[model samples]
Target: MDPLLILMLLAMGAFGGFAAGLLGIGGGMILVPFITMVLTARGVPETLVVHMAIATSLATIMFTSLSSVRAHHRHGAVLWRVVQLLAPGIVAGSMIGPWIGKQMDASTLAWFFGAFVAFSATQMLVNKKPAAARDLPGTGGMFAAGGLIGTLAGLVGAGGGFVSVPFMTWCGVRIHHAVATSAALGFPIALAGTVANVFYGWGEPGLPDYSLGFVYMPALLIIVAASVATAPLGARTAHKMPVRRLQKVFAVILYALAAYMFWRAA
Candidate 1:
């Protein structure tokens, strides 16, 4: 591997990790598109690029989420009850997400990813507050919401924060708590997504060396190492930033990433 490529992967991990901590995302929104770029440049088959990117991005979240949640826990911001309620559904949805993804062509999948990311960004940019009387739904409702969040996140290789954060806030959870809890949710999403992606992608032709199904081991290891290092820093920063400001900035970034995915699809 080229030293330059190594540096690029490391940098991606750092940025992704920071974003994860800062925004409660699993950093897949940032990592997926960029990973596509890297894999493309490395002469990976175009057909496999997006799938690998999504899989590798999700895998990294497994590590980044731990580092991020620890920081949030330190701040006493994590909502463990919420995590408990959502995890089961998230895992179930995550397991199926890759199977759906496997049925789609790469271009179609890219378009779907772009569309959802744009929607998520718009929601963040709008930053609408729900009615004061509104509150989190019952256990059944939460399971349904978690299932949806996990499915979409698995499809796009994200941490599910795009959906979870807004949903929590809409239900009257504070922005900080929402962010922390979302970070906590990333682990289950990543774990289930990773396993599913690997299974779905297993034995696919034209995979590069060091590949485990759709996951590129080299990229996964590098990104995880780098991301975990920076995640704590991002988590700390999230506490200091104004919620509205953070949302705006993150929204803009997501929009840019969405545009990139669209371009890739084209």
Candidate 2:
């Protein structure tokens, strides 16, 4: 709620949003950690700040995803078939992640998050195997991928793109299309994750003010506004650069954040 913090968040949003759009990352990976700093600085109960940040970032992704997906769609990169195939699974898995997140301590969540982020980064650097492209399985495979992405999403409060993008790319979807379709998945991931987070934190004792469910609205609004404005810029830039380098760079940043989260969690 402090004026200075609001400005800082918006500024961070603009920068992170641009990178997210260009990279097909949901930005929550970065935003949640940044927000954890803010919430903790404001004298919030330390135990709850990380949870609130993750939950709130997931909520914001629902809105940011629409804009990023549109940009990717215009590039003719989004494969609707893929999004349709994976969505149902995402919804089912997301419904339960937040509840489980609530049951654990923030430190445990941070460790889980850090490890996951590091793993995703390594996958990016190594260019992991691709998935079946449009050759979606009848029922079992779809359910499996969706379940995995969704459950992790709920547990981590992510947009699920970290897993979804590579999986699709390996499956035979082109990189651009994989990223675009993964962007589309953010909406459902965020929505379902948001609902569960709210319920998870609803009436338990000891929470910060200006929270809706587990989200801090002030940070949410600033992040959404700035991310929306800059995502298109990132989308346009994504094509202009050597994506291999970009992936590595992003991976380093992820590692850096992962380290920071680990330290903080400790």
Candidate 3:
């Protein structure tokens, strides 16, 4: 890869990592479209670009989530119990999601990604609280919710924070706690999703050089290195800032990205 391209990857990682720490997101939403654009520009087949981007994004999230979680843990914000409740279903759903994603055409996946992102952005902008505050759900309910989060995250190459944080907040968890917990949840989602993607794409044709199944190693390494360093910084910032305001800004960015994806898909 050109040194310029490497620098661009690093830049993307830095931005994504900062967002992850600040918002308790896995930064997959930010990474996926950018990675897809880059890969497509490099002459990768359209049919395979989105999968490779998503897989590589998930791979990077494994490291970014760990770094963000550690920072959140330092603040005693992570809810380990919630993580435990959600893990089993999240793992199961994540493992299956990439397999399903692989079967979709690139245009279809792009449309889905765009629509889902737009919805998330709307939710963030609305910032509507639930009509009635309730405690966290029963184990069965949590498991089912986790499954949904993991499956969506896997398909879109997200960290599951957009769904998890909002759901937790709606259930009466504090926003900070919800964000922190979402960071923890990202690890399992990314790990399982990445493993599934690797296996699912193994022996598939037309993958670019330096790929391990669907993952593009060069982009992964560069992004991970930059993201890990920046993630802690973002977490620190999150602790000092107004979270609601930050969320709104993040939502606006998501809307813009969604528009870009929609255009690309069309």
Candidate 4:
């Protein structure tokens, strides 16, 4: 890789890691589009660029999630019981999601991602609260929700926070606790998604050199090194900051990214 490209990857990792920790996201939302652009600029085939970007983004999240989750765990905010309940379905859904994505045209996937990002941004901007408070659901409900979250996360290379956080808050969990638990959920989502991507893309033509299945190894390594170091810092900041305001700012950013994705798809 060029030295400049390496620098760009490092910068992206720093930003993504901070965002992941601060928002309880897996950072894939931030990473995917940027990585796609980089790969395209590097002459990677357009057919494979988006898939590689999504897979590499998920792979990087594996490290970022661990770093962020550790910080949340230290603060006693992670709901371990919830994680245990949701993880099985999350794993299953994530494993299946990449296969579904692989069947879609790249342009179609880009459009879907743009729409999903826009919807998530709108939800954050609205910040709607549930009309009535309710407790967490039973095992079956939780499993179903987890399946939905994992599937979407895998399809778009997100950390599932855009769905999970709101869902938990609606169930009467505190926002901070919801965020912390969402961070914990990211690990399974990313792990399963990455593994599935590898199998699904193996032996596919048009993939660039230094790729493991769909994942671009150089970018993943560079991003993970920086993201892991900075994620804890973001987690610490999240505890101290006013999260609602931050979420609004993040939503605005998402909206801009969504527009960019739409333009790229066009």
Candidate 5:
């Protein structure tokens, strides 16, 4: 990789790590678009750019989630019981998501990603509070919800925070707890998704050098190094920051990225 590209990846990792910790996201929302840009600029085939971006994004979350969740755990914000209940279904859904993604063409996947990002941004911009009387569902319902969140996260290369955070808040989980637990959940989602993506994308043609299935190894390694270093900082800030104001700003960014994805599809 060029020296400039390495610097760019490091910067991307720092921003993504901070965002992951601050938002209880896995940082995929930030990483995926930028990774797509990097891969596309490197002359990767359009057919493989999104796949590599999403897969590599998920792979990084496997590391970032650990860093972010450790900070959240220190703050006592993680709900371990909820993580236990949701994890099994999350793994199952994640295992199959890449197979589904493989069936879609690059444009279709880009469109799907664009729409998903737009929806998530809308939710963040609105910041709707769930009804006070609502509460988390039974174990079975939690599993089902986890399945949905994991599947979408796998498909979109996100940390499942966009869906999980909103769902948890709706179920009366405190916002901070929701974010923290969602961070904990990111590990399983990324692990399962990465495994599945590898299985599905292996032996496919048009992949660039240093590729591991759909993942680009160099980006993964460099990004993880920088992201882990910044994630704890972001997590600590989350305890003190005005997250509502931050979310609005982040939502606008997401909207812009969504527009970019649409343009990429076109």
Candidate 6:
């Protein structure tokens, strides 16, 4: 990749990292479209662009999630109880997500990405309906939701925030705790996703050099370094302000990105 392009990706990484810190999101809404555009502009093979972006983005998230999770944990925002409650399901699902992804074609993965982005936009646009706390689902539902969301995250290279937040919120977890716990959930999402990308791409023919599975290492390096650099700032901001309002603003941004993804994928 060109040096200039690498620089731009680095910038995007910083911005995405900041957003992850501020919003408890994995920065997928920002990262994926930017990566797709970058790879497409460079005339990478049409079939490879989505796969590359998804894989590379997930690879970056492997680090970014840790940064944001740590930041949130430091602020006492992370709901460790919830993380524990969800861990078994999340781990089991996270493991399976990648295997299922290996069975999916690249284009199918892109479309899956598109639909999820659109769904996230729609969900973000809605008003909150606070459910009773007692209604929070137990082990079975946790496993089911975790597995499905994890698979989608692996397939699409997302941080799983788009699904995890709303699901937890609806399960009677408070909004603040839901977002905080979702930040932690990103860890499993990223780890599972990165691993899956490797499996799916493993032994496949004709991938770009320095790529394993769908990941492009040069881009991964730039994005992760920059994102981690800026995430703490975002985390501080989140702690000092009303994040729900921030989330609304971010949701509009997600809506726009969803539109862009539709246009590009079309």
Question: What tens digits encode model 2's per-residue C-alpha lDDT throughout 160-255?
Answer: 888887777666777777777888888988888888888778875677777887988888888889989988878777756767877788888888
> Model 5's lDDT to the true fold?
0.92
Q: Return the TM-score for candidate 5, rounded to 2 decimals.
A: 0.97
lDDT of 1 by residue, 42-92 (tens): 999989999999999999999999999999999999999999999999998
**TM-score leaderboard ranking:** 5, 4, 3, 1, 2, 6
lDDT of each: 0.91, 0.82, 0.90, 0.90, 0.92, 0.77
Residue-wise lDDT of candidate 4 within 1-266, one digit each (tens)?
Answer: 89999999999999899989998888888888889889988999888888888899999989999999999999999999999998988998898788888998888888888898899888878988554368889999999999999999999998999889888988888888998999999999999999999999998998888999998999999999999999998899999977788889878988988887888788
State the weakest 10-residue window (summed lDDT) of model 3.
Answer: 127-136
> Considering lDDT, which of the candidate structures 2 and 6 is the better prediction for this target?
2
Q: After superposition, how far is residue 34 of candidate 6 from its true place, in Å?
A: 1.1
| TM-score, structure 3 vs. true | 0.96
Off by over 4 Å in 3: none
Which residue pairs show collisions in model 1? none
lDDT of 5 by residue, 133-238 (tens): 6788888998899899989999999999988888998888998999999999999999999999888989989899999899999999999999999999999999
Clashing pairs in 2: 130-170, 130-171, 131-170, 131-171, 132-171, 133-171, 133-172
Q: What would the TM-score be for candidate 4 when compared with the true structure?
A: 0.97
lDDT (C-alpha) at residue 23 in model 2? 73
Task: Answer with 2 or 5, whichever has the higher lDDT.
Answer: 5
Compare the candidates by TM-score and give the number of the best one. Answer: 5
Q: Which residue ranges in model 4 land beyond 4 Å of their true spot?
A: none
Model 6, total clashes: 1
- Stretches of candidate 1 off by over 4 Å are none
Better of 1 and 5 by TM-score: 5
Per-residue C-alpha lDDT of model 6 across residues 43-127, encoded as one tens digit per residue: 7777778777877887887788888888788868788867776666666666666666556666676667777777776676675
Clashes of each: 0, 7, 0, 0, 0, 1
